[model samples]
Target chain A: MLNVKDVKKDFPVLKNRDVVYLDNAATTLTPDSVIQSLKNYYQNLGTSVHRGIYQLANETTEKYERARKKVADFVGSDSPREIVFTKNCTEGINIIAYSLHHWPEMEGKILVTEMDHHSNILPWRFMANGSEKFQLEYVDVTKEGRLDLEDYKSKLSPDTVAVGVPGISNVVGTVNPIKEMTDLAHERDALVVMDGAQWLPHRKFDISEYKVDFLTFSAHKMLGPTGLGVLYGKEDLLCRMPPPFGGGEMVLKVDRRKVKWNDPPQKFEPGTPPIAQIIAFGASVDYLNELGISEVNEHVDRLAQRAVNKLSEIPYVDIYGPKEGESRGGLVSFNVEGVHPHDLATALDSLDNIAIRAGLHCAQPLHEVMELNSSARASFYVYNAPEDVDRFIDAIKEAKKILGGADER
Target chain B: MKDKPEIYNQDVVHHYQNPHNKGKLSDPDFSVTEENPKCGDRVTLQIKLDGAEISEVKFHGHGCVLSIGAASILTQMIQGLNVREALELTFDDLVENMGNPAKMRKDCASLSLNALKKALSGW
Candidate 1:
């Protein structure tokens, strides 16, 4: 069992007000350890890596590479050379889509799920509209808001070049069966890309266990600093794919007539990276390791289940995602009848200073399937507690009285 | 607005629920639809011109309270006003009629007015 009190103390923002932050699906609060590591890097050694041979540069390079190794070990990768740093999860996915167009013999079909965020959808849309002319297909989501395995099985074929799906739905918090999906895709020789942005912070993940070709996630969503993301690929796949961007540090040798590319990880990283944030991200991994990802997952799941039960007690409120007692991540997306999500969010904020996300949650297509313009989402993390869920439920009742006056509860 | 929820005052909520002139105008002289893609707030404003006056004005769409309330308030404000007078109305006029919205909701408050302006400009 994890202690919510200890985790809350690590985040200074939690003390700023009587506010209940239920927007962890968007971005998590950074802990003091991550913040202190950031300060230590900039205050003590403010220098670039892989450029200088001096003690400072060598130390910085070692720390940076050590962070990469930490991330690799955290994800259970065979080698640290497989992890490439990027701006955010969006950039990591874009790199794969960018390189896919140039694969000479690869087919043009790409299968994606409707439950994916826009970042996962748009990159492939660009490929289809651009010169690559890739045929993009969507796997239908079941009525329960989970991916339809039947639709996915039919969609997977020899022509399908890649399959991109989120490990967990950001809106409904449905934890998809990624390993089975990956195995099915591999049977047809199709590569699987898992959007681990919402998965890494909530559960235990091992890259080799899932056998995914590419995994992308953002640090900010996992209690780390922003402007840092990870793209972990199988060594053979990374070596086979072309570099997405070319600039300093990515090339071994440059010539007017010929150019020699660097190794897999370095070949993808162009220009100076976010060195400070990466080091802080290492601290965040350490924080998670100390608490244990399985315990964190259990804590959040307990909170989410309690929230779902309390919110479902209100007759006027409609919750989306998994059924009661089903396994889901630490989030609940819902809406009150006859009340717009924005109005409900504003009402909740005013009543109890509760913070929640009230929008499409970037899965507009999923909302379209749900037949709603928008919905409000309340997501929990390590720091959130059952008391917070109680407050959220009370605030929802207040919103119902204020906004959904015409609806009966 | 910071300490309290001034955005959805009683007046705004009342106007949102019991909006005036809230259906399609029959045989409308002009019509326009606008959607704020951010939150999927959409509104369509229709007008029936009686000579130089806007004899009838109605709106049909879905949006948040601010946009819907502003549309209702705008329709009531310009129902009997002349076409020239309605065209001269600014976004400030809309804000004055409805309470000032938050910085993020400025677009929601002005969406109906912008659509109305576009409808008249295209005329």
Candidate 2:
């Protein structure tokens, strides 16, 4: 069993208030170790990497590159050179979409699922709309909010260039079988792009075993600092794709008439990176490693299992996600009989300081498929405990009374 | 009952629960639907006009308390007003009519007004 109380102490925000933050899908609370790492980076040796040869600059460069290696190790990638630093997961998706025009092998349809976040969908939508050759299609979601495998097969054809899928749906919390999906796409000679932003933090990720062509995740969602993202691509594919941006460090040599772009990872990173955040992210990887990803995954699953089971017992509560006994990532999106999701979130915030997400959750198409305008979502991370879910349920009952209850159905 | 937040006062709650003219007109001169894409709140406003004067106005849709209350309050405000007068009802007027709402929710409180404005333009 994971020690919840001991784990809570690492996060200063959890210690200071009565805040039961259940919005981990948006961002996780940074731990003290990660914060300390950031302060140490700025207070001791604050300098841009690859810019100087002074003693402090050398140390800074070493730490920054070490952070890259740490992130690469954390994700089971053989080489740090395959990892490209970005602003967030959204930018990572954009990088692939923008660079796709340069690859002639990817001449077919871009098959994405309806369950993908707007970050995953909009870039492809823009790419498809801008180009006459690229055709974009969606894999339908099942009634249970799982991706319809049959629909995915139907969309997969010889012309399919890439299949963009979420490791888990942020709204519905469906834990997709990404390895199987990746294998299926690979059989069709289509690349797979996994939006790991929502799913990576909750489980043990091994890209080596999963063999996904590209995986993108935000550092902020995984107890690391904000303004930092990781895009892991296969060495061969990355070498072929065009750099999304052009600037100083990204080029081997630049002249008025001719220029040569730098190597794979460096080519992708153009400007001064988020050095402090990247250094701090290395500490977060250490922190999570100490706790063990399997333990974190189990702890979160237990909370979600308890939350879903208990919330379902309430007559008025309608939980939207996988059925009980099915595997789901740790999150519960639901609606009470009459209270609006926003109003319910506010009501909970008023009483218990229980923060949650209440909106389209950037999966508008999935919400439309579910016929919900909006729904309240409670997501958990390693810091969250079962007690938080209990308070959430009680607060929801209180919300129903104040909002005049949902229709009796 | 717990004291409501300023954004969810008794007036807003009452209007949300018991919205005014909440069903669509059978046959109307103008109708339109406005949606807040971020929150997925939507309202379709139907108006039955009498030439330059407005004979009836009703709204039917689903949204948060702020939006539903705004729609309810808007129908009451524009029922007797002319088409030009209804169009003149600005976003600020709706905020003033109801208690001030949070900055993030301004669109929620103005959904019906936007629909009403669009409907009046078609008229």
Candidate 3:
């Protein structure tokens, strides 16, 4: 029941006559409201916060705090104190990585999935290095892109500190059952961190209801400005975890020798934050809230299903991940026969200005597990419609013809 | 030139469709495989030499139009050149040969050039 026409109007980039963007999974186009909010921030109240006692700094600080509350409310967290701002999702993961390294009770193994993005995988690997006490194990995924629960169950042990899993895959668009996976990990006395980078913009997710220990996502993926990310941790756990960085604005008092870090959200934010981007992120959340998340999910699901069906009809195209609409998200990954993913993407772009992602999508382990070096991915969002799918399919067919057909192989 | 296709043209498409000098040159003086892995582009280069004068050059692999075209063109370009001359082929030359491809497609088009350099490195 989502109106693509109305949604398309919100993004000025859609007006480009030749461009048909299908690379939403990489990053979405910012809405007009978010862009306006960003412009307003710089034009009107551009000042350093928490330092000056002037009216401009005070107003900026209040607006920044308000943006934090908006992000917390969007994810169904009770208080804004739980939301910590970072550079991007990669920094958010690193924050947790550094915090776990400092934990007194940190011991044993960390459970992760082979399907995790490099952002989720490398930080833990870097933290576990030279520590004989810590081990890292990955849960294997099935060929259909579903997590093998049996494999996950076998890896769960008493010494597991946390299980980091992606809510939705960047490459395959497989939606993991975070609640179920977290519940299983909890039974084994392990904390859970959900990488919601691909999940937050497309679907409705309630952090309170899910009761996940921590969740992280980049704002740029959700139609906001770049260089901003969100990390939502339970208040109690966040208060106990040490801050990854220490500098101005994060400390309550600084002595000659020692310094006392501020409480939960503020401690994690070090140095000058990306104030304008955060303000724009708040506008993006407001825009998404207006278009209900459920409706957005429904729209994306329809587009993805339509794309999968139409692309399947083309001979020599092999799709990855779940076939059922409910099991997958708004993305479809595939490789065309007799063509490299880069070639297919390039051909498609030339023929019809259709932009699709082609690569390992920063999930090298997932590709290694699937035995594929790269894949062509087309992901959808609220602005995408059935007509977009038709055009995308037509572009692919044209690419095949221009590349001398699949029969040429 | 502005009216030409962005990165796909008749010549590039034809090379991708029916690439010349494809497949390995058995018992050749030099051979190598280069891959981008990000875009799943793979290329294997095989070169045969007759006392510093190129005797035969061939390539076999899987990749996109730019990559395939570059490999096909590379085989044709390096046929009579010495190993040092073959090593001089840069990404710019590859893009120039394809009517100056988009900046994004440069990596794909340069695969064959990189493979030739890799093959020469072993020699």
Candidate 4:
């Protein structure tokens, strides 16, 4: 079992601030080790990566590539060459949406779930502009907030070319069975894209085991720094796709009329990347490896379950997604009867300095399907404790009183 | 740094509970609905114009204390003001009238003002 006290000490904000942060799904608090790695990179050596024959340049480049290998290993990828660094998960999705037209499979229907974040949906929406390239279809979400597998099957016709799915719903906390979903998509000869922004932080992923064509996740969502995202594609698929971005050092040879792009990973990552952020991400991977992902996953799930049970006792509150003791991720989404979620969030902040996410949580289509305008979400991570859940629940009850009673509506 | 309780004082609660001019005009000159897309709070303002003078105003929507209260306050303020004067109503004026809310919730205080401005944009 992970020690919450020891884990809390590693987070500087937790040590310094009088707050209970339950917004880990948006971004996790950075550990000191990760911060130290970033400081070490800038303090010791600040130089451009890649081939520069000088000693410092070569050293920095080695560390940069080493970070890539560490991330590749953490995600169970076969080779670091499959990983391409981008701005964030959104940019990674865009890179594939823009580049995958090079393949013959690009000209068909695109399937995406209603539970996916806007980051996964908008890029494909922008790409499939007029149905000339691909027409977009949505796999329905059941009333209980799980992905409708029957709907997914009906949509998985031979015309389906790409399927973008999330490993976990940010709003609903439903852990999608991507392996099963991917296998079904594969049977139809469609490429599967997994948005792992929520899953990568909480669970251990083996790319070879799941066999997704591509995966994207944000470093900031984990204990790592921002301005860096990982896009992992199969070696063969990445080489076949073109790079949507172009700049210095992306090409082996470029003249006025012709350009010979670099290999798979290099071809996708054009221009100067976030060198320090990626290096610090290696430290984050090391921190997680030491703690063990399964333990972290279990700890987070327990907190979510605890929160659900506590909130369910209140007659006025209604929760989304699975019930207590069911399979869900680290977040609990809910709404109070008379109090708006925004008001609840503000009241919680004022009462106990608690931080929780409110609003659409970037899954508006899911909200529409559920017939809700917005909802409040409380997410947990390694540093959070059971006391945090008690405070969160007590604060919500107090917030209801302060905002006005449940019968006000 | 704000006393959040002060933002939801008796006046705000009263207006939120018993909002004035919160209905649709059966035959209105111009009507506009504005939404805070981030939070899904909406405000719809209906107006019946008597030439350049504001004849009647009504609003209805679902919102929190700040939004619904501000909408009620705004409808009461613009009942007889000219089109130009109604268009010139600001969020600061709402904040001043509501005792004082957090500057962070200026969007909440301004949702109805945004609707009023959009309703009279042609004028």
Q: What is the TM-score of chain A alone in each candidate?
A: 0.98, 0.98, 0.98, 0.98
True-contact fraction in model 1 equals: 0.32
Taking the tens digit of each residue's C-alpha lDDT, what string does model 4 give over B1-123?
Answer: 224444366687778878899899999888898888778888898999898999999998898888898899888888889999987777778787887665678888898889888889987
DockQ-wise, the better of 3 and 4 is: 3
The DockQ figures for the candidates are: 0.42, 0.45, 0.48, 0.45
For all candidates in order, state the fraction of native interface contacts they contain.
0.32, 0.48, 0.64, 0.36
Q: Model 4 over residues A283-373: C-alpha lDDT tens digits?
A: 9999999999999999998999999999999999999999889988899999998888888887888888889998888888999999998
For every candidate in turn, the CA RMSD to the true structure comes to 2.1, 2.3, 2.5, 1.8
**Residue clash pairs of candidate 1:** none
lDDT of 2 by residue, B48-100 (tens): 87878889888898999999998999888888898788888889888888876
Order the candidates by TM-score, highest first — what do you get?
A: 4, 1, 2, 3
Each prediction's whole-model lDDT (CA): 0.88, 0.88, 0.86, 0.89
**Each prediction's TM-score against the native?**
0.96, 0.94, 0.94, 0.97
Instruction: Give the candidate number with the greatest TM-score.
Output: 4
Q: What is the interface RMSD of each candidate, in Å?
A: 4.4, 3.9, 4.3, 3.9
Off by over 4 Å in 1: A130-133, A407-409, B1-7, B50-53, B81-88
Report lDDT (Cα) of residue A339, candidate 3: 72
Off by over 4 Å in 3: B1-7, B25-29, B48-51, B99-103, B121-123
Q: Between prediction 2 and prediction 4, which has the larger TM-score?
A: 4
Off by over 4 Å in 4: A102-105, B1-7
Q: What would the per-residue lDDT of candidate 3 be over residues A1-409, giving only the tens digit for each residue? A: 9889998998988876557789998899988999999999999999977788999999999989899999999999989999999999989989997798788888889988999999999999988888875688999988777789899988988889999999998888888988888888889889998999999998889986677898999999999999999999989988889887878888899999988889879899888899999988999999999998899888898899999888778877899998745568799999887677777777778777788999889898888889887899999988888988898887776666656565765
- Give one digit per residue, the lDDT tens place, for model 1 in A1-409: 9999988999989887677999998999999999999999989988999999899999999899999999999999969999999999999999998888667777569999999999899998898885554899999997679899999999898889999999999988999999999999999999999999999988999986899999999999999999989999999888888887989999999999888889989999989999999989999999999999999999999999998898888888899989789999889999888888888877778788788998888889898887878888999999998889998898777677667555431
